[model samples]
Target: MNESGNPSQPVNVNEYDASHIQVLEGLEAVRRRPGMYIGSTGERGLHQMVYEVVTHAVNEHLAGHADTIDVTITADGRIRVADNGRGLPVEVRESTGMSAVERQLTELSFAPKPRTGYWVFGGINGLGLCVVNALSSRLTVEVHRDSHRWTQEYEKGIPISAFTRHEESSGHGTAIAFMPDADIFETTRYSFATLSQRLQELAFLNGGLAISLTDERPERPVRHQHLDGLHAYVAHLNPYPSSLVHSPAIGFTSENEEQTIFVQVAMQWNTRPPGEFRSFANSTRTHEGGTHEHGFRTALTAIINDHARRQHLISPDDEDITAEAVQQGLTAVVSVKLAHPVFEGCTRTRLGNPEANTYIQETVREHLAVWLDHHPNEAAAIIRHILNTSI
Candidate 1:
């Protein structure tokens, strides 16, 4: 607010505001600016929408309300996500003056806090459920909670009718049946192999989470399940870590009491220079490294140098190892489970978590350093591997 009855900074054509405010009603804005919500209108964006909704389903499993999640692409261009969770809450919402079932079926954009939103969801944009609904021509949600089975139909994100409950026999989970709106999408169908690989990655990250998919369109459905968690994830990425580590594991975590960020790292260095690194911010893999990654690197370098000094491993005259040198031939995953993951950009590729840097640095510095000392043989083997396995 300003003295002349204007904002402190009067927004001009160059600024964001009233004119910039997108008053997209129904699904018009989604078709126009699909990228803003799904991150793109292309393959990545298309996959994002699927993942967003799937993540919403997964959140229930993460909360112990689910056990099995199945995703499959049907020949008719429908995506079916079935989970053994409690089911989508369908009570009435006092805020929107609509039934909770209606919101889940036709108008959920982002995950709402329980009661406030009435359920746990892992939607990145909050508009995930709604966006998917609005983009698709038809969306249906079936929930079997408390021994009562119910279903709802949505056409382009609008409910054709309120939820109708039936006392028929039903599974004790929730099933969402949706057909991607062909009008909004270039292709309403999905790829089995691509989606399978993604689902595998997620299963690996979540550990003990089982997901199965059957591509009925192909005569036989494609199915996969991973119970190994990150251990399997590490093994999948670097199959020969044990041979390289001289011990059972390659890189390990350093834990401390005042951990402001969850520092979980597993790395296997190969002979490749500038070793490949992957990061995740609260289960969403950050393809682009963020502040958490920065801190992890800093801690990694410091720990190695300190260890070198204690063991007289490196001649004082030798140059300290470079980031590339440390990473060379290494497949490392750093997963930070922060309370709230603030991404650097709208696409959420990088974690813009500032506090993660310091938190990781401190914890790793203390814990990893001590671990290396106790596992002297393993440390020496890794240091040697880094020196030898470079292009």
Candidate 2:
């Protein structure tokens, strides 16, 4: 207003003082801005809450602490997640005199960061159990450990009572049941199909992990476990399975020991478009393909083009096939496990680590080249398919 030569009113500079600097202690920040942590207050966010809890259990399995995870949608609109794993430590903390389980649920500071040489997919966005608890109207946890059973209850992120210990339990594990806060979410109803697809993908992504989804609302239960892992995943995603250029998917894994990164790839070409080309980092789907995807595509195009020229399938003067052409009719899954994966955003939809590119590129280059050279018939068929698609 002053620059425009208009009469300006007196401003209260004191109005923007220390009182405006409100500090949100404990889990209050999550509740004040649920969308900032959960991405939305709609159906997607509701599902994300379920994913966070399930992901925690999956991490246990990834760390070799657990093997089986069971998820149930109760008739009363509550989610129950149980796992056969080493339960959360119940030892009392010296600073707060609270058990580890209570601290994990009540404080956001407990979220673990990506450390060296450990494979985990929990709280990568700095939101996990605590966020789940904050946005939940009612949450209960049961821990079977230390040769005894421990239990606790919370209402709207506040502990209703102290943790109680019971008689010795037979085995060690953790079970959590939570009801999403109606005030925070647009809808508390869970989607069975959406949750099933993700759980199935997780099972395929992490081989030998058993996961079961039970809809207690209707008493429907299904189990998912894949020893063949990504190979089975690619086959399942193939839309043109009958028209595959190769009978079985080509799968391989490579590791960069110094960097502590592991890449696993499974690929199969078909005679159709709109095929699946999925990528994941640290067991989280990278919806927006990032460095890892870039590396995979670059290596694939180079290998195919070089092979075509060497085999005289294409003249030396012919332009190298584009990455798009090489990927046409492709059904592949690229999964990379990095101890310190760098995701581009809080949503974790894109990978950003530069080292991931080199790791995946080299892995694909070496393994794919060998596969093509070993299987001339399948390789030629794949090349022909690409050429036809280009035409």
Candidate 3:
């Protein structure tokens, strides 16, 4: 045995040579370390695969190039995502000598190219569709664009069929279908309920964009389209209709001069304690929150305290209502769309943009104050409920 108390199978220092080094080409790296791209081999990672594909379609909707998205869990255990968007470019690239769609599915260096004045959540890591292609045992992409249909098939990121162009039969769109590689994932099965909730959330985040989820196993399909956007989201979060302090969720939308930053806010007070608070940056849920959430909480507490003092609900000598007290029964959703959003944390679940903080604070303070002034009865009820609950 070695002094380290090991197996002592071999002690050849020269054997640790350069030949052992491996250079994974194309999507090979993604197959080698799946977790680094998708987060895990568990259910969470499985869902992330769906998100990566869906987010691509959602980006099209965000860019005003698409309005409808469809996701299906096939009876054969495959997944399909389709969108009525400007389908992927089919022309060959001069630099790579490969069609744009083929390169996107086979290479890790290609990030999604959104049109100018638009923002997207995917492709930040430049993996995008390539990661999905690499991790899937089988993948097929169908594109309808410029009065023609293009189709390609892949197996574990390698092209198994020629890229074929056929006669045009429908409007422009993109569709992708894949079977998760059992060797790379702990399980290939998916939860329809998990997918439904997220697709519904996406529909709410992108108003007027219809998103549908179908499970071919049961042949059940559900669709979500919210014209009211975050207002609908806030109402959905507070399921107890009778417990609301306000009749409808207070909602507003604001944008900066360059139109680079857009903020949408919706909030409602409820009788229930520990109400939900959700925040998103460029359609990505900020689970851990960050500067935008901080700005929201700050503005909300200050406005409520100021209003309470003005109405003599609390004396000048009396202690101000604490932030915890203010949030006791508050349900709110804050969504910020930044041209260049900064995210932090290992999971990339927090917005870290400093400008987001200032913009959110000013926007919330201005809009919420106007809302309170317009709905004096609701404002009073909300404050009273907060005071009663905090006691």
lDDT of 3 by residue, 320-364 (tens): 899999998889999998888888976889999998999999998
lDDT of 1 by residue, 1-391 (tens): 5446777766455555577676776466766777677766666766766787788767776567777888877778688888888787767667876866666545535346632211222354455777887777788888898678988888877788678788965567878778876666666567777788888877876667787777878745655556656656767776555344543444445434543345667766554445557787767778888898899888888788778767877788877877666766666777776655677766667878788888888877877787788988878877887666533
C-alpha RMSD values across all candidates: 6.0, 2.2, 2.6
lDDT of each: 0.70, 0.87, 0.88
Q: What lDDT score goes with residue 227 in model 2?
A: 94
Question: Candidate 1's error at 204, in angstroms?
Answer: 1.4
Model 3 regions lying over 4 Å from their true place: 1-15, 116-118, 122-126
Q: So what's the TM-score on candidate 2?
A: 0.95
User: How does model 1 fare in lDDT?
Assistant: 0.70
Q: How many steric clashes does model 1 contain? A: 14
| Candidate 1 vs 2: which has more lDDT | 2
RMSD of candidate 2 to the truth, in angstroms, is: 2.2
lDDT of 1 at 254: 41
TM-score of 1: 0.84
Q: What is the descending lDDT order?
A: 3, 2, 1
TM for every model, in the order presented, reads 0.84, 0.95, 0.94
Write down the lDDT that model 2 would get.
0.87
